[model samples]
Target: MNTNPFKFGTVVDDEFFTNRKEEIGKIHSILSSENHLILISPRRYGKTSLISKAIKALERPYIFLDLQLITNIEDFTSQLLQKTLKYYPFEKIKHFFKSFRIIPNISLNPLSNEVDFSFNPTMSSSVILEDALNLIEKLSTKEKKIVVIFDEFQEINKIDKNLDKKLRAILQHHKMVNYVMLGSQESLMKEIFEKKKSPFYHFGYLMQLDKIPYEEFFDFLTERFEKIKNNGSGLSKEILEFTKLHPYYTQQLAFNVWENLIKNNSEDIKEVILNSVITHDNDYERLWGLLNKTEMKIIIALAYERKSPLTDEIRTKYMLGASSTVFSSLKKLIQNGFVVKINSSYEIEDPFFKEWLLMRRAN
Candidate 1:
C-alpha cells in the first residue's frame, strides 16, 4: 500500500520520509555520552517517529518499548525481560535465563515460541526494580551497548503512583546502557523531568521535536504528490502554502484531496481540496461536546480573538464568570489536549480542529 507523505494519525519510521537530520544528530550526541534523555512534545508532533528513526541510525543494539502497553510492575518486568532476550543469541534464550537468581518462574509457549519469566521475592524484599535493572545491565555487559527507548514514559505514572521515582532511582545508577524516555503529554512529561524534587530531574538530556519546516515539507510533498499522480493533477503552490500553515492538516488534506482526484480522474483539485478542509472543520463537533458550556464560550472567544495571556477584560468579553474560571478552562483544555499553551498564550494544537472551532463559532 502507498503511504501518505504527510502522516497525521500515526508514527512513521525513518525510511518513510526525508528531513530530521538535525534531530538525528542530537540523538546521536546523547547516545555518544553516558547520559540518558527525556524527549518531550505535544501529541502527534512526531516524537516517536524521531526516536525510532534515531535507533535505526545508531550502531548499538536497541530495544524500543512503548510504555503505553505496560500496566502493572509485573507487565513492565516481563516486557523488559522479553526485549532483553531479543538481543541474546538464539541458543542462549532459555538456558541463559536460568542463571537469573532474581527471576524464578520460567515457562515456554511452544506454539508462540515465547518464554515467560517471573520474579518471586521473599517477604520484606524491596529491590524488584533494582534487580530488573541489573538483569538489563548484565545483558548490556556482553560486548554490546543496549539503548532502551521508553516511548510514552509519562504513562508509567498511571502504573503506580510511586513507580516513576522507583524507576528513576534504578535508571540513575545503571551505567552499562543508554536510556531515552519519550512522552507527548507536555504537562505530565514536564512534571516528571523538570521538577527538581522529582527523581528524574536533570537525569537526562532534553530533546524537543518540532514540526517540519513549511517550505521543505512543501517541496517534499509536492514532489511526492506529483509522482503519485504522474503529473495528472499537480498540487498548486497556493494549496502547498495552505498546507504549511497546518502540519497535521497537510497530510490529512492531501490524503482526502488526492483520493478524490484519483477517484474522479479530475485535473482540477481545488474544489475537492476546499471540500476536504470544510469536512475537516465539521468534525470539530466532537471537541465542542467534550468541553463544558463555559469552556465552549472561552474556546469560541479564543478562536475569534485573544492575542495575549487571558486577563480580566478578556474573561468578561468572553462572558466567562471570572479570570480564574477562564484560566481554569484554558488549563483544562490544555491538559485534555484540545489546545496547547505556547509563550503564555493558548492556541488549538490541531490545525483542523482550530478550523472546525472557527466554523462553529461563525455559524
Candidate 2:
C-alpha cells in the first residue's frame, strides 16, 4: 500500500500508536486479572481504535463487538452466535446452540455454512428478553473464557431501559468470562456504571481515557511523516502547536491539512492548518444545530470559560439553569460520547470540535 500521512480513522497498532502507555497498562491490568473494565471518553477520542490496540496486546482470546449495528435483542443473539461459530466448524457449534430448544428446528447447512436456529420464546419471555439472556448463558458455558467487549454501551440503554440489569445478572453468573465495556459518551457511561442506583455500577473499573499529550503526538507524527516523505513534505512545530492537543481533532486536522498539502504538492511548512478549520465553519454549524439548548449553552460557555467542578455561579453566568440541570445536560453530552470532562471540567470531545469552538469564539 502507498504510504501517505496518518489519517484520523487509522488504528495504529502498539508499535505505531504512541503515548498513553500508562492508560494502556491500566486496561491491560484489568483484563489480565480476568476483571471487567469500562472505558469512558467522549466521541472521537479514539476509543474504538485504542481499545482495539489494547485487545490486540492481550494474551487471552478476545472478541470485539460493536453494538452500534446491532439494534434489536434478536440481532444481538444472532450476531453473537455467528461470531462464535465463525471460529469453529459449523457442525461443532451447531450442537452448542441446540438446547435453545425453543429454536427446536435448528440446523446447520454444511454447504452454505449457515446455522439456522428457529425458535421463538413464549410471548412472556420473548418480550422480557429472558430467552436472550438464557441463550448467552448457554454460550458462556463453553470451554473458552470469553472476553465480551461491548462498544457503544450507551446505546443499550436506548434499546432497552432494563438492559443493564438483565445483562448484569447474566454476566455475574458467568465467572469464566471477562468484559471490557468501551463507551465514547462519558456522561451515559458514567450514569450506567458510576451512579450507585445503576445496576451496572461497580460492574467494572471506571477508567477515563484522556487525549494523548501534544508533545508526544508531535513527536509521533514527526517520525511517521518523515518516514512517508523525508524532507519533501513535513509538519512544523508551530503549526502542530496551534492545532490543539486533543486526539480526535489533532488526527482529523492533521489528516485534513496533510492531505491538503500533499494534494497541492507544496510543503511550505508554514502553511496555516487553522485555515481548514476556519473555512469549514459550516460543517460545525450543522453539528451546533444538532445540539439542544442546554448543550449549546454549555458548549458556548466552555468555549470562553472552563472551570473545574463547574460551580453554580459559573452556570448562572452562562445563563444556564441550576447546577443540576447543567450537570445533567453535561452528563448527557459526555455519555453521548462527543465531549469529555477533564478533572471535573468539561470540553468538546473531538479535537476538531474543540478547535472549532475556539475558532468560533475568535470570530
Candidate 3:
C-alpha cells in the first residue's frame, strides 16, 4: 500500500475513525433533541473526532470552533460568525450584521470566495459575543436546529470573567440550536456546570468519555494490520497491550509499527517503540523542562514504579521531601494533565513520556 491505514494526531473520520459507535449514537440523539450537551474527557481521547463524526452523520446545518485557539471575546465572536457565514452566502447574511450591537468588519477570501468576519478591537467583547451567539439562533431554521460545537469549552472563562453568566443567559433561551461543549479538562468543566453558584449549573446533559474497550480495539487493530504483510503473529495484541486502548496512542503506535513494517519489513515491536520514543524525544523534553523540582521528583518516582507515591517507604526511598510538598506536586501534575488518578492510584497520562523518562534516567 502506498499510504498507511492507521491515522492519529488529527480528527479521524470515515474508515480511520473507530470504536465510537455507541457514543456517536448518543451524540446523534442528543443533537436531535432540544437539550444541549456537556461532554468531558482528558486530552486525546478522540473527543473532537467523535463529535465531528456525529455531526456529519446528523446531516444538519452546523458551525464549529475550538475555544483553545480562540484568543478573546472579539476573536470568539468573529470566528463564530465566520463559521456561520460558510453555511450562508454573503448576501443572505449581510443583513444580520446590522442587528449586531457592534457590527463586524467583513471581507471575502479571494480563492474560496468564503466570507471573512472580524470585529473592531476597540468594541466591547461581551456585546459582540452575545450578538454573535444570538445571530446563530436567528439563522437556525424552524425545521432544523443548527448544531454549534465549542471544543475546549472550559476555556470560556478565560475570554471573560463573566462569560459564563452572559453566555448562559443567551443560551438558556436558545430553542433553535443544539450546543455541544467539548472539554478535555474534566475538573474545570465540572466546576462550571456542576457548582450551584455557577450560572451554567445544570445547563446541559453531562457525558464523560472513556478509552475504547480492549476487545473491540484489539479486533480493530487485527483487522487493519492483517492487510499488511505477515501481521497475524500476535503483534496487534501486543500493540493494544502497549497502548492500553488509548485511541490516540493506539493509532500512533499502530502507525509507527506499520511504517516500520512497510519500510524495513521488520516486526521488531521493541525497536518500533524505541524509535517512536526517540521521534518524540524533543517534544517530551520540552514538556519535561516545565516541571519544577518537586514535580520532577514526583514524575520520576512515578516512572520508577512507585505505585503509591505518598507511601512512607516510596517517599523516603525517593527523598520526595515533606508530605505537603509531595501532595502539592501531585495535585499540580494532575491539574496540568501530566498525571491522572485512575481507580485509586495516580499514573502518568502519557505512556511514551513515562518510557522516555525511564530511558533518560537509565542513560
lDDT per residue as tens, model 2, 1-363: 434555565666654467577888887788767579888876666778878877776645565678877766665665565565655556665565455534444577799767754445542333334444454445554355557778888888665566677778777766666788988766667778889998888897888877787668878777766654665224735445555566655666556556666577655533545666567779878888789988888877776775732677677788888778887887777655556677665666655566678766777
What order do candidates take by lDDT, descending?
Answer: 3, 1, 2
Better of 1 and 2 by TM-score: 1
Overall lDDT per candidate, in order of appearance: 0.71, 0.67, 0.85
Candidate 2 lDDT score at position 361: 73
> Which runs of model 1 end up more than 4 angstroms from their true locations?
1-6, 90-101, 118-126, 228-247, 265-283, 309-313
Q: lDDT tens digits, residues 1-363, model 1?
A: 545545556777643455778888888898878889888877776788778778877767888888898877766777777777677743665565555555556677699787675666551123555665677787785466899889989898787778887887777778989999998788888888889898888888987777677666667667767766775224745555554444455666666666765677664556665565577554666666788988877777666775633766667676788777777777788888877775567776665566655655577
Residue-level lDDT tens digits of model 3 in 247-316: 8988999898888888899988889999989999999999999999888888988888747788888889
Clashing pairs in 1: none
* Clashing pairs in model 3, backbone N/Cα/C closer than 3 A: none
